[model samples]
Target: MKLTCIAVDDEPLALGLVCSFIEQTPFLELKGRSSSAVEALKLLNDEVIDVIFLDIQMPDLNGIELARVLDARASKPRIVFTTAYNQFALEGYKVDALDYLLKPFNYEEFLRAAQKALNYKELINKPAVAEAKSEDEYLFIKVEYQLVRVALSDILYIEGLKDYVKIWLASAPKPLLSLTSLKALEERLPARRFMRVHRSFIVSLDQINSVTRNTLHIGDINISVGEQYKDAFNGFISKWN
Candidate 1:
């Protein structure tokens, strides 16, 4: 699929380099170029873009802020951050960017990042052809007063409080906290992809890195498997082993 992109960078040379790379790539089409975030906003309003090649550091509004603004819209294009700064990588993920490309990056790296954006675009646009199982393979949760759709594949783990569930996603920084019972959530999730390792936690099987007798490592978080759930957990471990 072809991707229509806009390049936004304060530096003229950086902007030119992105344009050159887009010109060389067959699947990418450079739709617009902006030296500032304000100009980029205008361009986005005028045209239909699939992805944005954004630079973190700009004169006035930065790329991160632009992403936030875009995210507030009904339909927003995917973002691929292209910047000289490495410190913003975490922040880039916080905004659900497709990928982060450091400045002076080679064609191969650019292609790889661009491909990720293309893949995400396809996933979003394609119809859900798979039949809905008795248990949910995904969730639609409210975040910032909007119902955000998240696939089971994107979830790392679910942390439960008394009357709330905090969803830790693979792509974002803050967990999405909602007023939902862990018991209610467990009933909705697919048994194959999710397992209740703890009374307070339900983790995605694909996101599990390792497990000890008591704890399962999901990314940087260490979650304890409750004693009550040990029987089922052991059964799951046996299957994988």
Candidate 2:
């Protein structure tokens, strides 16, 4: 299936180059192009865009913010971050970007990213089986080219380390390593049962044995709640008692 997409970049030359690459790609159909995030948002609302080739640093609303906004939508398009600086790679993963293209990248790199997006699309859009199993109680995590089914109830907490996240599970002797950001995983979790109490930690509310002023004890493990996340964490605690 041909994936319809749009290109967004503040630089005219960069935007033109991405549009050209999209046109040359057999599976990608160019839907639109915009030099501003605001205009891109409007385009997304007006059209059925499947993927977005977005530049991270732009005037007014930046790509990262735009990504967050899009991610909250029910029919969000896949994002591929394009930036000159590699520093925004982590941020790209935060929004669950399919791939990232470093500036000065060739058509080869662009095609690779596009292919990844297509594969991901196929994985998520596959038809669900008619079964009694609770699909909402589990997640399909992509690990080493394979998608592994992980029960949400078996999870103790998630630990973020740069671009990777370690899923500590009650059923496993070792944590399951996955190449994804904590923020991205947090979005997949049921909000009522999971809370991001720290930048690097996402704790299951049911697994939390106790909560100190600034820390939470999950069995023997102690996780410190960040200062920024304290108020929200406390608010979560207050609801229980």
TM-score of 2: 0.62
User: Against the true structure, what is every candidate's RMSD?
Assistant: 9.2, 7.7
Clash pairs, candidate 2, are: none
Off by over 4 Å in 1: 131-188, 191-200, 203-241
For residues 113-152, write the lDDT of model 2, one tens digit per residue: 8998888778666666622254668888856433578998
- Candidate 1's error at 30, in angstroms? 1.0
| Count of steric clashes across candidates, in order | 0, 0
Where's the lowest-lDDT run of ten residues in candidate 2?
127-136
Candidate 1: worst-modelled 10 consecutive residues by lDDT: 128-137
Each candidate: what lDDT? 0.84, 0.89
Count backbone overlaps in model 2. 0
Q: Quote each prediction's TM-score.
A: 0.63, 0.62
